[model samples]
Target: MRTEEIVAKALEKIGNDRYLLSNLVFSRVKQLCAGAKPLVDMDLKHNKLSDIAMKEIAEGKISIDRIDEKNL
Candidate 1:
C-alpha cells in the first residue's frame, strides 16, 4: 500500500491509538523476519519490514486480536 493509503487505514482502524498500532506493527515485522509471507502485494525489493507490515494493516490483512494490549 502507498503511504497515504496506509495512513488512512491506520486512522480508520486504529484511530489515535499509537501504542496499539505500534504493537501491531512490531508483531507483524517480527513475523515477517521469521519468514512469514507479506499479506499485501508490495514490491519487496524496496520495502522494509515496517512498510510491508503497514501495508498489511492497511489492507486488513492482519489484526491486533492476538495482542494483549493491557499487558503493554
Candidate 2:
C-alpha cells in the first residue's frame, strides 16, 4: 500500500487523533532506532523505520493500549 493509505488507516485505527498518531509513530520509531523489532512483517532494508511504525499501527499490531501497557 501507499504511504498515504497507510497513514489514513493508522489514523482510523486511532480514531483519527492526529496528535496520538504522531506520538505513537514517534515512540515506535525511537524504539526501532534503538533496535526494537518491528511488530509488522516488511522489508526492513527498504522501508524506513517511520513507515514500519505506521504500518504496525495501520494493521492494528500497535495500539494506544499496547503502548500504555508496554510504556513504549
Candidate 3:
C-alpha cells in the first residue's frame, strides 16, 4: 500500500492521535536502528526503518501498550 495509506492506518491503530503515533514510530525506528528485530515481515534492506515501524503499527503488530510495557 501507499505511504499515505499506511500512515493513515497506523494513525487509526493508535486512536488517530498524531502525537502518540509519532512517538511510537520514533521509538520503533530507534529500536530498529539499534538492531532490534522488526515485528512485521518486510524487506529490511530496501525499506526505510521508519516505514517498517509504521507498517508494524498499521498491522497491529505494535501498539502503545506494548511500547509502554517495554519502557517500564
Candidate 4:
C-alpha cells in the first residue's frame, strides 16, 4: 500500500492506544520516504509531525512524539 494509506490505516487502529507502536510506525513512514527518489514527495503527513519529529520517521528511530504529518 502507499505510505499515506498505510499511515491512515494505522491511525484507524490507534484509537486511544497511542504509544510505542505509533512512534515506530511514524518513524517507518519517514524512513521509507527518505529512501524515496524525491524525498520531499514521499512524506506520510499524518497527525502533525514537525521537522525534528520527522527525523524518527526518516531514520526509523523510536520517538516520543504522538503526531504524524500529512499532505492530504
Comparing 1 and 4 by lDDT, which wins? 1
- State which candidate, 1 or 3, has the greater lDDT: 3
Q: Top model by TM-score, which number?
A: 3
Runs of candidate 1 with Cα error greater than 4 angstroms are 66-72
Q: Compute the lDDT of residue 18 as modeled in candidate 1.
A: 77
lDDT of 3: 0.91
List, residue by residue over 1-72, the lDDT tens digit for candidate 4: 455654444444544344744565556456455642223333445433433234333433333343343321
Tell me the lDDT of model 4 at 22.
57
Which residue pairs in candidate 1 have backbone atoms (N, alpha carbon, C) closer than 3 angstroms, thus clashing? Answer: none
lDDT of 1: 0.75
lDDT of 3 by residue, 42-71 (tens): 888989999999999999999988888767
Q: What is the C-alpha lDDT of each candidate?
A: 0.75, 0.91, 0.91, 0.43
Question: Between candidates 1 and 3, which one is better according to TM-score?
Answer: 3
What lDDT score is found at residue 60 in candidate 2?
98
lDDT per residue (tens digit) for residues 22-66 in model 2: 999998888788888988887779999999999999999999888
* Candidate 1 weakest lDDT stretch, 10 residues: 63-72
Ten residues in sequence with the least summed lDDT for candidate 3: 63-72
